[model samples]
Target: MTVLSYADSALSLLPPVVAILLAIFTRRVLLSLGLGILIGALLLNQWSVLDTGVYLGQRVLSLVWDDGAFNAWNLYILGFLVLLGMITALITVSGSARAFANWARQHIRNRRDAKLLTMFLGCAVFIDDYFNSLVVGSIARPLTDRYYISRSKLAYLLDSTAAPVCVISPVSSWGAYIIALIGGILTAHGFTETGHLSAFVQMIPMNFYALFALALLLCVAYMELDIGAMRKHELNARKGNLYDETKGLPPGANADLPEAETGQVHGLFLPIGVLVVATFYFMVSSGADALAAESLPFTIIGAFEKTDVGSSLFFGASIGLVVTLLLAFIQKIEAKMILKALTSGARSMLPAIYILMFAWTIAGIIGSLETGKFMASLASGNIPFALLPAVLFILAGLTAFSTGTSWGTFGIMLPIAADMAMGSHSSMMLPMLAAVLSGAVFGDHCSPISDTTILSSTGAGCHHIDHVLTQLPYAVLVAVISLGGYIVLGFTESVWLGLASSCVLFLLGLVWLKWQQPKNTNA
Candidate 1:
């Protein structure tokens, strides 16, 4: 009856690897995730039988929307998906799929463009992390598939882009988390000097860990130099070989429609343009000035005043899809045709939407676990000053991975790392804190339990665990190289070396993969 108790949360939630396995094996993400949340709440609440069911939904929703934030702004994230569905629907109704196939029929050149386009989009949406990941993944997945990119590759691109961009952006969720965490740490370190917020402002330019990760992501995308799962998949794709198909995408996701008809796919770009422009305008003009990672609640409220809450930011994008369908209507498209297009788009996202709610629910449960206290305690003590950054990185990674929420991890670890910086002899307090946040994201970006990871896999229509197993090897490699860089960083005291080391390791991996491909092909 009890999933876990307050006294047992440490044991009950440890790793969550089993939870992931069940979700994948049953092909039941929503059920598995919902049960996980229910168990989590029951663990904390210690409720009796009937009361558990009664409190389940109530607790989850309350936790997700306690300050009315989720109700007010979660729409921004989902809105793009809805819009994507709309564009796909309209493309279908306009016979654009046929047109697209026809266009591709004549234009066959390079697969490299797909990888480049994905990286370009990832960098473009640097201001908003969630919007970046979801929109980029949705937009690029189909395009990447055309070039024979694997779903794992697609998820990797999506995952890689999200946190790396967020870490660099002075305005997104990452910004806010660092400010909050660092400010707290500054207080503990007796550096009322600049406050923790100022520490983040100071920290950004010095965060070599995140800077290096972003660099690695771009290098891999640009050079087509694959390593880890990416290198393996590239070799297979090049030889017309396949990955583990049982856990991979269906043929329809990659192939052209069977029995093609004729028309144009003109509206594919409009709604996305609307979403992009609107997000920038709202982010800039809504007067949120989220650059300071200022008040999240106020920012969301301000956005609603014009952006219509988070939903409004993407409203234009969604309507843009409808407008595309309307173009079809104005050109003599039947009402049924438009509605069917819209309907198809909505249906396509049903699975993702359902799973997202469960993901949100689990996140709520983890947040309730009071991660801030746990991480803060861990950061206290006589650890070596030089090893502080690496330790913070690993701890932040663990907290984020276990909690399934990087924001929560940031809330808990950033301040702690900042405090460690204060207590230590190092003058690079800001850099140390940056390492903490970046490390949290390293694990969060790849963890099976992480909501972002789930969302990315969902966006690509890939099996989530498949994304995890394949992506882990690469994420771990980057972490290890970065860790080595951090170790030498203590003596060199140079951010450049850390960045250079990450780049070098990535290139080395690329070369190794290329050399091994002949063997892989021969075998």
Candidate 2:
């Protein structure tokens, strides 16, 4: 599909809004995404029905085949998802999950401990959001389930920590990508006061949303905080309902698998350990190969910057699946049962795979529509210097929300932000850029179409809409507080002062929530 002449106009916002609203109200993800893509096609084709149909069909087909070639990245990611599902199912059939749950029960004394442990695991797996979401959720689900912790709550913990932690850690995939983007932006704008890595470190304090989101997760866990639809989910979970049965089994769920009584804890630990180590090694190794091809030195950061994450994840998951199969064989599980687990596991991931395809297609249409260009345009022309950071945060959030991608938003908005700052608010460049990062994460954190959000729900075996509805309030509250912090940073030109104010505000917000809860209720 070609870019429409009015691509940068307000008209570009209509499809995403229509899709998001439909998804929220009807809880039908694929239907909503399909309609959105159709609507976008209509707009691009000037409302010609046949043209719209053709364009929409082409875009959907382009997911697997584009420009006379296969789309390797998308296919690789799909392969990884399938392999991850098989591995998870095998673990359950082998009773590794139950065995680990039994082992964890000895160490985790109560529900609070379970929740806290989940948060800690989420934070620990910060190398990649996709890896973190699945691994942490798989490791923590059994323990959380043992304590009757809600799957929605577990999903919230996973979703909140993945991007927020990754966005801040310099060694993370998100960090390396953003650092490379920053390097280019800095070079283009002739800013040499700091290198890309140092600039990222400096901006960490100013990234109010990421910091506040992490803090909010800690407070929610320790304080047993339950906001919005989450409260109902928690109430249900306490009664042994981990998720809404009316909605059917969620993605990654395999309730029919029987537990093997003889399973050992190592059955779970060794596979996950292998997955992490293999994935990390592949990421670095593949990154190094890319560097070698370019005649560049092999530094960890440089390797990460050029690494093909999709293929790396695919390779890692494949190796992990082999290990999982070996463990099952060692335990003397029936071959028939092992084969069943593989088929069933792949089947379970079908919904997520479908939703992901729709999401990517719509995101592609959104790109052609120039949604981010229109969004970034909103921040130009006449903004006051003190309000620049706040405006950028809002714009970035809106852009990411509409496009369902933080990295795409970063690509669109970062250079615009650099230009805006260098053109006038020179001293506020770091804060403005930080606000974009903060907002992008904030938007991506809650958006229904976001891959991380979808994976978080899948990992926790919670309904996708349930995760989105439950997590939205918490994400919003943190964003509001972060917005206030950016406003302060903009005016004061002091990152510390802004950060301090956000911290105080976050605490106050927590206190208010505590006051609102009924004294006798557990949540």
Candidate 3:
């Protein structure tokens, strides 16, 4: 079969299924991505005989490299990780994290406040979800543990909010790429009128996935609707069957907690502050381009037309790291110890980074195979057009869940869905698109093997499996509500109706969960 035809056979379902299967069997999402990508590339290459793998690799690499924006995001993520690693090192070696923990331990009397603080700090680092995860996870790991909040749950919050929040915020790294993608797509399809600003602005409200994901995260965090696998896994997913993995309360877990240095919390705030100032400055200055808003006068930045969030963040984090290292040097902190903490943190990120490279390669394969078009073709135009919005949302949701990327889901869905919307339900186009985006995010927000989920797990010091297990139910809860809202929006043509339906669904789910629990159980 032709690549596109086979793509018609399997694209959305295959990628995610492959990812899930790999992660479950091998405990490695990257390897699965590699395999999936290889299959995609091979399909794209028409399964050429005699040295097909070699031919496929060359073609796929060439195609991916042909587009600069596509390639930059991967490197951008990698470079961004450096700052996160350094900041982690800086915080640890400088004893700032230790001091903060001590301060919080003594001052904070309320557990709810502490949980909210974790979520608040997570919101504070809105520039990049990846950045948010690494920084927040490392910082809040201890704080969450102290309050008896499970690491799995903490990771869930961090991961859930990271990508969804970044995508929603214009200043975040994610927003930049999606904007660029949208601009290109709109311009290519003659959809852009007068420089694409209006089109982009219109897309924001339609981004249902981002909005609902944020709502879902808030629901999980403060509302504490820890039902389903959340309550079950939180109770069980501990290491070695002897420890609580979600809460990190297993024996010997805290044995590694630093003596006095772990108790230090000075200079930790500096890195965080720099991140905020730099992010705000860049976001405001760039106006709309992800990189255009930064105000970097030094380090070869003055020569550039635009300053990327990745570059700005990396720079700010570097300064924070240097300041931290200096603090460590000025004090009697052991250099070996400092280096070890950094090395450990860096080591911890390897799996995530590896998975990303593979994810990119796999996503590339799917793109090369024209998977989006194939999936687009699969839509049954004969079906009631009213169902399109809801179906699109569901498709987008599944795509995001499968690929673990909302943007990928959007990229594949938006054009065709938009075309369908424009042709059949002209007025509902904007809301329809929003539903697609919303569905994409809903899937990504909850998926166990998604990069964001992985980072959240890493951030919260929650075992990867634990986070996935705990977070899945919340994602489903929100999704079910969102689906009902999409149905209302499609049929009623009223945005308010869809929104109201989703709210009702959410409240109903929460109430049902509460009612289903055993009476007089421990809070």
lDDT of 2: 0.89
Clashing pairs in 1: 4-43, 181-415, 183-196, 227-231, 304-309
Estimate the TM-score of every prediction: 0.81, 0.98, 0.81
Model 3 spans > 4 angstroms off: 1-5, 11-15, 25-73, 176-209, 236-264, 279-307, 518-523
Question: Per-residue lDDT tens digits of candidate 2, residues 161-182?
Answer: 8999999998889999999999
Candidate 3 yields a Cα-based lDDT of 0.63
Per-residue accuracy of model 1 over 81-114 as CA lDDT, tens digit each: 6676666656656665556544543563556566
Please report how far candidate 2 places residue 43 from its true position, in Å: 0.9
- What is the TM-score ranking, best to worst? 2, 3, 1
Query: Which 10-residue span in candidate 2 carries the lowest summed lDDT?
Result: 1-10
Error of 3 at 128 (Å): 2.7
Off by over 4 Å in 2: 1-5
